[model samples]
Target chain A: MSKVVKIFHGPQHPGITGNMSVELDLIGETIVKARTHVGYLHRAFEKLVERRTAMQAFTIVCRICVPEPDPNEENFARAIEEITGLEVPERAKWIRVLVLELSRLAAYHLWMGGQAGSTGLYTVPQWSVGYRDYILDLFEELTGGRVYHMYIIPGGVRRDLPDGFLDRVSDVMDLIESKLPEFDRLFFDNAVFKKRAIGTAVIDPETAIERGVVGPPLRACGIASDVRRDDPYEIYDKLDFDVITEKGGDVYARALVRRREMEQSIKIIRQIIKYIPDGPYRTKIPYPMNWKLKAGETYVKTESARGEFGYYMVTDGSEYIRRMNVRGPAYVHGVSLLEDMLEGAQLADVAMIMNSLGTCPPEIER
Target chain B: MCTDNPGVWEYIANWARKHSIWVLAYGTGCGAIEMPPTMTSRYDAERFGLRGAATPRQADLLIISGYLATKTLKRVIRTYEQMYDPKYVLALGSCTINGGMYWDSYNTIKKLDLYIPVDVYVAGCMPRPEAIIEGIIALQKRIEEGRAEGAKKYRENIEWYKKNQREVFGDEMLPDYTWNFEGGI
Candidate 1:
């Protein structure tokens, strides 16, 4: 008879993407059953948002997911815009696209580090995290905050681009692009990484779709669906870029999708730099001190680095928000999908699978 | 509690402890993101002898990086207690002090000091890597000066801390020392 032992994987584990735990009933090195638990990072954001004004609520929403916070801000801002029928300026749209793409690049870099780290590759995180810091530097210059921008608001961005900000951004882009070949040589095309990731955590395309997997994880399964292309938001419709996909739904496929998406994001950023119009960055809204909204409900979704980040907001003609619900991809990917994938998986591959899925616990619990 | 004062060996110990602090790599919140950069080449926290320890047993520092939900509070205390003696607690972000942005949230604790004795608090919605480095320097100074007695204080005032911890985690009581020796295989 095979003896089974139950062990808790996280809540403070290094391999865990955030504050989450996976209970694994294991026999030897093979996992028999897995259950994901997440309440550690819960700040009751949905309930907290109800107590604040729209502007104040914007500040808090970004804290939902730390790695790629702009998506939450983007969703919240767009939801309010949709509800109020507010039309953002053309330049603002371009800037929003730029912010979104830069955010995607940053998240991908962080993910690269996590993926590599999970596989016992330390050089990748050391290099990738350093590179990510440059993007954070740009974010600091633009929004006055490194991690949480809170720059994207209902009407438009909070402020205009600083002098030569585009030039600085281009410099960082140039540096990152130059290092891609080195990264490919070291991580993507490396024999060790390929051996570890290629066939691991293989997801069926049909299962991916039925399971509502979006973004690179879904695209990695050969479905050429992207929120930017399928449901165009901001100036994504006007931009020119392809929705990248891979036939293999394993960790390797997802890595390739993200790597190619990085190149695509770079292309999109260059386009924004060239085509951005000269105009007001934001439209002045009426006094925020006592800002009131008409009774309404709206849902807005954006392609965050993880997957789809959607916000469902309701207002009852009051200054305070009536209800706000965040539907982060991690909610699905971290709990249900993680549990499904971890079954029968070797205990050692659990962190690798979790990292590839990009599970952010704060978003799940919030 | 039985130690002597101002000995030459104590100074040597303080200096050695100040130079080598193994920080447990347990990221409690948003402030966790900043740690990667701080430890990496750009900020290089390792240069200051601040390195990531995989478990509590080997760590000398416990950094509560952001807001702590009640659920996490239980685990943090457990992890804190698990660390070896002569430990320090460094609280980061405004969330640790007066609850910062999550002050009104139902689950997040208001003041971190009430639950755990914090040695240093770095103020920011989420403090930058530079500020974090500065906080580390301050902590190092405190260690050298032998003023960082948070763990000692925790041990001395066990009843007060236990009372506060009980208030936060009502019925879900935690074991005093988690590692049980009596439970045999």
Candidate 2:
């Protein structure tokens, strides 16, 4: 007979990243019930957006998802474009794809670091984060900031790619591609990582579909439901790359999906570099402060590194937005699916399982 | 083996303080992004003995990285309470000091020290990895000099801190919607 023991794992656990907690009811090392505790990092971002001007809200939207912030900017830009009936220049579209894919690469690198770190494979974090900094350096050159690029605006991006920007990006991609084999040796092909990650936190295809898992976690279960492929946005349809998927639906499968996706991201970036048209990167909006969007609502979804990142914007012919709802991947991954998946899993696997889902607390808290 | 040295315990504690500074990774906002780079090999914070701890109970330092909304402040205060004595608070980024870009924003507190005792303030909108290392070094100096008594003083005046925390988080032990003021931008 098993006795139930309760443990509060976070709002501060190393396994659980960011400001969130999980109340675990355990029978020995195996977990019986896991309840997620949020509100630790809750800033009421959706409500905060309702009060700010449309342009001011642009800065705030990036805070919704820290790891894949570009999607929020892209969503805001697209929604505003739909409302104002603005046409994104062909060059800007390609540039948007460039930014998005670069963001995807950066995000995937960070995810790989976190997932590996959670499983006690410390070297993966060391290598991946160091590599990811090269991407951040590019961001610092392209935008002004490393993490919050606030460069994507309503009409278009803030500015065109700088002189020799493409070369810099290509060089970074080259370096990242070259480093992949070493990462494989250190992490992917390593026996310890393979042994711990394989078959752990298995979410069968049926369960994944039932839980509405999106992005790599969903694709890891062998569903090729990439928003970029199915519902083409920007230049994704034109750009050729395979949507990587795996059938295992475990921690290892998720890691494999992300690893393959990084390669795919590199391919996408190469396409953007080769075919980027020479034109204006941004279309002028009248003036951000005085600009009033026409009365309309648009729901735009983009595949971010973590999963399907979507924004629903409702404008009421005013300077301020009427309603803005952020549907982050964490809602499905962290809250709904996390609770169900933790059942019967060993206590030690909690962090690994959570990291595999790629739960961004800001995304969920927003 | 030195019987004459009465300050040997202090010497050992000082040396341990330089190497084994356990960090409470209290991520508050956007500046939290810079932490991974510092912790990773590029900056390698572990060389100086800065390791991220899960619970505040075992941590010797609390790194409040980035902005703190009124909602986040409540939990931060609670976490601070749980930390053991001889702990030091390191405030990273300008946002943690004077709210940086969000200074005008209603939700974010203007001064972090108004709520909690901060020993070191790392000034940058988002400080560079080098700046973070400098902050840690400065903190180590303070610890060695015995000037890092803010945590002890905070424990002594716990009620005052709790009161300040309640003003933001409210009288309830945990934050509720009433504490959330959805003022206009």
lDDT of each: 0.89, 0.83
The digit string of per-residue lDDT tens for model 2 on A6-81 reads 9998766667767778899999999999999876555667777777887888887887777778999998888889
- Looking at model 2, give its docking quality level: acceptable
TM, every model? 0.97, 0.91
- Compose the digit string of candidate 1's lDDT tens values, residues A1-366: 599999999877888887889999999999999999989998999888888988889888899988999999899999888877788998898999899999999999999998999999899999999999899999999999999999999899999999999999899999999998899999999898899888888899999989988788999999998888888999899989999999999999999999999999999998888888999989878688788876899988899887788888898889988998889998888889889999889998998999898888889988
Give one digit per residue, the lDDT tens place, for model 1 in B1-185.
11238577878888989889999989998899888889887899889999999999999999999999988999999998888777899999999899898888889999999988899999998999999989999999998888888877877787798899999888887886453335310
Stretches of candidate 2 off by over 4 Å are B1-19, B69-72, B99-110, B174-185
Top candidate on TM-score is: 1
How many steric clashes between backbone atoms does each model show? 0, 1
DockQ of 2: 0.36
lDDT agreement of model 1 with the native: 0.89
Q: List A-chain TM-scores for all predictions.
A: 0.98, 0.97
- Determine which window of 10 residues in candidate 2 chain A has minimal summed lDDT: A39-48
